[model samples]
Target chain A: MRPVRISQIYLGLLLALLLYLLPWGGFGLLVRPDFILLVLLYWLIRSPHLCNIGTAWMMGMLVDLAEGGLFGQHAIAYIVAAFLAVVYQRRVTLFNRWQQAGYVFGLLLIAQTVLLILKLFSGGELPGLAYYLSSISGILLWQLVIYSKIKVTGDKELG
Target chain B: MAQPQQPTAFFVRGPSPFARLIFFFALSIVLMAVDARLHYLTEVRQGFATMLYPLEVVASSPIRLYRYVTGYFSGQTTLMRENGQLHLQLTRESVELQQLITTQNENAHLRSLLEVRQKLHYPTKLAEITHIGRDPFVHKVDVNIGSQQGVMAGQAVVDGAGVIGQVTRVYPFSSEITMITDKSLAIPIQVERNGLRAIAFGHGRDETLYVPYLPANVDIRAGDKLITSGIDGTYPENLAIANVKHIDRDPDSPFARIVCTPAAGTDRYRQVLIITAPPAVPQIETEPPATIRKPSRHAPRQD
Candidate 1:
């Protein structure tokens, strides 16, 4: 019911970045969710005026730098996903909680699919289906956050 | 009755979401092109990596603390057992070392008589692995030692067992070492049994090295030990690299499919030695007319 604060959004993004920077290895890395993207999507859907496509693009660039991959691969993926979320932002606010979760899942999958195509184009080998594990885990984390009373939409019930 | 307030139209958001997406998408494509093909963003990458160093350390601190705590609480009996094994190994090696010293003295005398070059001794620095690479597709590790410790890119990294990797990127206080299993890394190796030399390339999708371009009839077999050939000048001569694991000879193909398992603990070891001093560059002679003439004379006879 309260308006989102700019500082809170930034603090959340920073915490997500820290989580992304953790020294994850082996099986942990395989299942590690894209914390930054999940947080970005939360703010983008909840407070589009504060976090727009440009913000997602910048966050994706930071991830690309951290992962040491091609400079703009994650950036492009995030922009595309952010754009999709923005186009359907009003519709998302009207959906019920379950429907909203499904929509968020689609957005996460879209980001990953874009990244996979970019990686393949740049001579990277096709990874196993386990590559999509991050997306699944990301959606689970989103549901966990929503269940904990952290609103991600304008309507409290949907959030 | 309440009067309706006029809505403000002047304070509109700058652009449509689609417009913003297109702008960012074009920017990203340009950046990717410049980064992948032109490599114009190396400095930008390095700067960001340096800025992210503190966060990296903070993230890794938990693992470091766990290791320290476990080590401190390790049982005395386990320590004693390790000490006893090390003492026994030292005594066994001392006997061999004594023989080696005598042989070295004899070798020096023979080398002087033959007017040969002195053997080189490389100086090495020890480094601890900080983290495995974040990307699963790349086989790299971050080490604690970096440029501040005089660590440089392209230095050979070896564990006690054998060659593990080479330093590919150096930050101020950390460096990234690409392991022998990384797709981009290639090592010049010699088959220890028959001195057959070949270039081994890392497989992209797996933890294996491929020795391509070698003919199917090549004498290499499974279990053949591979050591650094030293022709590339990056790795020192005769360090254990890998052992042949599988050899598939296709009748239709000209090359044999040779796969090898790295001798060093590619996924196991935490400490490694980075050879700091590069091998001496051999002098190139400007004049070798006699050698050129002999090769030319033999060329026609072989034809």
Candidate 2:
């Protein structure tokens, strides 16, 4: 398998940020996936040496700035998720595609739950159940990427 | 195909993942505290927003192009129909405008004679909404105009219907409006019918405003219109704000639970007018009448 280039990872993260910056409105905004987090997670799981907790925290800070919410909410959430992913990186690579997807889904949920808690602490009201829809959509997107034969785990390592 | 085995790292990275996590987590908590408590990061936020302008433009281009195309392809019949309706409305309003001019002239003469403060004519600039706020929980919108266009923070934004919001943050080329339905916004309002004044707060989870702290037996009723009292000096005087929807008066509770539907299109409109003038400060009379010295029970409601 070809080694993943550091430039490619950075470019992918940038593209995800741009997608996040899109002018989503109405129902689209409610269900929009956390594109930057998903990309950061993918890199952390696939190429941990290249992208680590600091990278995730930086991206999370960017998200927080863009969101215009409580300043560090997304930063802490992303770092926590990144930590989980890094700690279980090897176990996740050994799993089958479905198991890996489930693990990623769990990480997404953890990120969201942390964010929700932070928001509540900041006096934000509880949003409806639709808040979790983004996690579901994110996992679905991950599945689509896997189906397209872009292995999240390094192919040579899997073999 | 032969693959190379993973090589052990010769040099250690700066810190372990957990240690780095702890450091970043603590840093984030400090940032959150500073931002929420002191609000010392306004310039930081504005600088980042300005840096993000190019990406925002790229992100919004698709919608802008779509709007341009659709506007270009609009049918001639629809245009003619709209034009005719506007013409008829203009003619009807012209009659009312003539009367308004005569009344304004008379009011000016009377105010001069009585040595009263002149009414301020606030200048307004029109702005187009660029995007709705990304966070669904916050009721805010980004408008195209900004400091470059003389848009300032705390200016009142309104549409043809009524007040929409106030400018909360201004960038170089854009500004953010925190809508009347946002959790942090509160507007001083007066009931149109009985002249009772109260403060209306936004319900965070919904698009309604709540008039809390009013006594259960307050004169406010369902369907009563609430207009800006202008006592707060943020919103203009007597502009429509909301219509009281539901008033829940529970026997156990001391305050009335009043829900109001906003008068403006809180989520629908694409254009609004920004009133740019700062609010006029009320003048204090030098000589006080003995009768007026004592506060009347209805004094607060007079404004």
lDDT of 1 by residue, A17-120 (tens): 88988888888888899898899988887767778999999999998877877899999999999999888877786677788889999999999999999999
Q: Pick the candidate with the highest lDDT.
A: 2
Highest DockQ among the candidates is held by which one? 2
CA RMSD for every model?
5.1, 6.0
- Per-residue CA lDDT of model 2 for B1-303, tens digit only, reads 223323344343678888999999999999999999999998898899888888889988988999999999999999999999999999999999999999999999999999997877778999999889988889999999999999989999999999999999899899999999999999899999999999999997788999999999999889999999887777878899999999999999998999999999988889999998876566678898887788788767765
Candidate 1 Cα misplacement greater than 4 A, ranges: A154-159, B1-12, B279-303
Residue pairs with backbone overlap in model 2: none
Which sections of candidate 2 miss by over 4 Å?
A: A154-159, B1-12, B109-115, B281-303
What C-alpha lDDT, on a 0 to 100 scale, does residue B25 get in candidate 1?
96
Q: Write the per-residue lDDT of candidate 2 for residues A65-113, one digit (tens) a residue.
A: 7777888899999999999998888778778777888999999999999
